[model samples]
Target: MADDSIRGISRRKFIAASGTAGALALAGCTQQNTGGGGGGDDNGSGNGSGGGSLSGEVIITGSSTVFPVSNEFAELFMDEHPDVNVTVDSTGSGGGFENNFCPGDSDINGASRPITDEEVENCESNDVTPVEFQVASDALTVAVNNEADWVDSMTFDELSQIWRDDGAQMWSDVRDDWPDEELELFGPASTSGTYDWFNENVIGEDYQHTAEHEPTEEDNLIVQGIQDSQYAMGYFGYAYYSENEDSVKAVEIREEEGDDPVAPSLDAASEGTYPLARPLFIYASEAAAEREEVAAFLEFYIENSGNDTVAEIGYVPAGDDVIEENMETLEEISG
Candidate 1:
């Protein structure tokens, strides 16, 4: 279990601050929407041209890990500019690029991992140039059932043994003194960037992840599955775990066998002590940026990427330097 001090932040405050009371209405729903309207008083907060009310649709797809951040931003942005309709879909990073982003169907795509070469080529083939922005930091979290108190930390090797194909079946198989019960595994599907990072970083490319486990794009499903069985284990972005920390126990991670384990938290991730800490990103379509609404929305997103509200959402906020660089990139791409 993670320290209560590290995992106990309230997401309710973030919802109230963003003025999106309905943010938690759906637990595992794929799509989220901010209602659309036409012509409202301009607040000059959205960085729109002429300080007039901005009206247009912005579609964001990808990254269940980064979904909370983008979804929150969309709600806040739409609150300021009621005329703009914003919809966010958690299609997984790879799925978003292959299906919506590369196809030029979405204006922006959030990602937990950097865009791949193949995805870049696919986007270029369709004449869509991707402009990347670092939005936040995530501590990819591995968790087990709250009642599974026999273990608290796992080394990379133990994690690989448990997740790799044809690997450990029982908790005792990984360690001599542990229980002999079968290990029920739940995790993100292969399409997810979270899965990709875990596969490459934890599971290693030499072996494939076990296909025998339950896989889903919804992080809530993973949490639910782990909660139902004492032997069940899973991994996901820290936000979901933070939101439901009482329902699961996070496993501290050790980079090697002898090193001290580090718990996942905004502070650890920001300080680079968490082994699984990774940068979160949102890629904007250059052509889409030409649209006044899209450009304004992107500008707003970059400017607010480092706001304290992000930490309330259970991820490390971007730094001032990163936000400044993102603003510069947005200008270069959108101007």
Candidate 2:
């Protein structure tokens, strides 16, 4: 992301930048590095409070959605271990896994969706064994403009009609009272884990697309699209919804067996009652885990992520118990 985070511009400003940015990707978005911190003192200082370096170079690339959380973790971890270089990249979840697991490039691969059998096979082909760690829970949120007040929440069936290809593209086609205007959609590419989650839930078995909303695969773009137009609708992980709530409005989603429509939130998402709720994961290769640097960084992430790091990045913490389990596992690996 750009420094505009502090400037606070309208979605229009973002779109205008998009037009000129030529294939603006949701990759490693570097901010002004806030260097200068103490080093050498891991008396369990936790989030780099004591300021000691972790000891080597660590690279992470994956879901743009996961980047913020992992980046937040990295920033804090590096503060303590400034000597260790920790890098997080968002090349889309599937892309991250392919690059890391196939070639085994990344120490950790963050994903918005669960690992596929194919991805697992790819890892095995490279003689890499992957172990998954559940970092947090997420609700796949869909948002529309605040101006469109007729609908507050929707059934999965309704959402399906709204976005799936060959399905009704107009808002009214899904709901009788909705306007006849066609709904302009925005979302990630097919390579994204978010896309797979969306298709399985929103698009039915026969779903196929003739066209798609583009150039803005990052959730921020979806936020911009919806904020720009009342008729626009898009979906992404809930963290984006929380970060862009002022500009975008969240729609309630009805789970198949649910009694009431629920809006996405940390509480609702954690319980799995939110229709679009699911777990977020990071799959790491044994080879990567063997590296002292990779081991230290991933350990730091699991620790800090459940602590202050993830929340700062607009995400909920996976419970303390889960975090403890991860830490214990890390100690086992390093010990």
Candidate 3:
């Protein structure tokens, strides 16, 4: 089902930037035959009309970080195939995959991080095989308040100290000479793939954030929260930070002492020097991809979103090799 969790100005800004108008329509969809017109009538007739008009609805749900790119793609795709209705929702990547995607509730799932084994097992239990596609790359950004003058760079050990169990409660606790002001921490909800990645990479996998930390699925909230607090620190996809650059400053990170701290940037993320840089993905159920409408949408999605649209959305586009591999994967499973 298409979800209605996003709202407000942030949602409005997101939609406007993604180039869609009106609120999303979230109803259970029924397949429509495209009639005897255009391309391969895996449905009926084959009449060429260039892009070939197609019909039917495709449901896309998952990571908020991936939402902008997907929404833009959906808008463009629907423009070309006006009869084809596509719905996109920004349920956190983990929640979408764990609850919606594994049960085969959505045709395509966007993820800010790779799918987990547990999610794969759940899909298998439900008799669904998902084909994976790499659509973009993102730097998991660690950001701080623009006024947090005491901060400059942080080592992984310092980050772990601040986020791990019974984590450091004040800036001074993280370092001997830092300010003693209380450190307000914000982060993604437990259902976010960004949350999973940060915990696994920064905090210990089995460990959890301190009870005092605030979490939400909305990255805009994290941006606002950090901006409002002088001693605050939070993290989200680089897109959020980039979009709100005036309110927040990205923290340079170092794996250890003696290493040069690197900030998140498109170049650093692309070259793999940014420690938190990772690939973004989309997963499609084998059953869904077999449908002509879903297949066409998926092909169109990668062809468009994998490059320029990705950069426009404030993330790195997939490399040429990555794009080719995803195309190969789509052909292999959907064919």
Candidate 4:
């Protein structure tokens, strides 16, 4: 696909003015460059480290939620092997696979949720089989305005009630003692993997109820919405919440009445007590795996971008067992 990295921002001018940090920031954003055949390594030292003699580009697009983790991995990978260029685009998970998998334009697709059966069928029909890798775990988080002191925690049923189409629109409607304030809702778009996971787990069969909440493809917009109003509450991947902890308050979640509520955190999510945890994935096409650069980058990603990288990006690691299984899967794919 076309590189839509920075629209009017010239890469060279941006690099010259902002240095390496700005280049890395530009890497993770949606930008474009039309003057060149393909982008090259203008940010790293021209020396190869322990990484193999792999040269060429590894293009990854998908999941704005997973973009930070993969972008960190790409930054580190290019540091070791400057000759190998890596680009990560933050398209939503479904758009990522659809745009890059059938025609096989990308080496890897970063996803926040599992690939659907229909997506798998489409790739297979196009002669591309995807090898899946579980990279990290994320706790879908709900947050309210920092001033919303009346709510400390909520049960799954209560959350469903708040989000239901014909359900409560006032805080006092949810709880008799609470003030009668109009409830404002913000959330991710239907195309977002985070949205899918929440819809399946929290909204249940009444998925159409989400129409009441304002939806946007951008997580930052949701964050901003929550920050703007005391009555506002919204949900997105845990990473965004963690990054904006000071501006918003995270709502504790309980599966049922008797269950103790659990706060969203690395420990709670990894231990399965968070009540809204889900696995994150990256699917590599078998055709792309044939390229040495693609293979090397996948190996590096599975091996190095776990605990430290996940934590740095405000996500929970998938544990040693999952990482080991991922390594095995990557080996099988490249073999």
- TM for every model, in the order presented, reads 0.86, 0.81, 0.86, 0.83
| lDDT of each residue in 1-335, candidate 4, tens digit only | 11365212223333343222211111122222210111223321112234556688888877767776777777767767778888877667887778775558877888888888988988888888988888888888899999999998999888888887688889999899877999999987666677767767887785445587887766777889999999999998877776678788999999999899999876677677789888888889887887888887777676554434465466765555776787677778777
lDDT of 2 by residue, 127-174 (tens): 877777778777778888999887788887777776677778678898
Q: lDDT per residue, candidate 1, 1-335, as tens digits? A: 11122111223443443233222211121221211111222221234443447898998888888877787777767767778887777788998899899999998988989999999999999999998999889989999999999999999999999999999999999999999999999999888998888888899989888897999887888989999999999999988887778889999999998999999887788889999999999999999998988998887777666654466667776776887788778778777
Model 3: lDDT equals: 0.75
Model 2 CA deviation exceeding 4 Å by range: 1-54, 206-211, 256-258, 331-335
- What C-alpha lDDT do the candidate models reach, one value each? 0.79, 0.66, 0.75, 0.72
Evaluate model 1: give its lDDT.
0.79
Question: Candidate 4: global Cα-lDDT?
Answer: 0.72
Model 4 stretches with alpha carbons more than 4 Å out? 1-52
Candidate 2 lDDT (Cα, 0 to 1): 0.66
| Model 3: lowest-lDDT 10 consecutive positions | 23-32
Query: Please, what are the lDDT tens digits per residue for candidate 3 over residues 31-70?
Result: 2222111132222122212364678888888898888777
Model 2 — TM-score against the truth? 0.81
Question: After best superposition, candidate 4 residue 149: deviation in angstroms?
Answer: 1.2
The runs of at least 3 residues in candidate 3 whose Cα sits more than 4 Å from the true structure, single-residue gaps closed, are 1-52
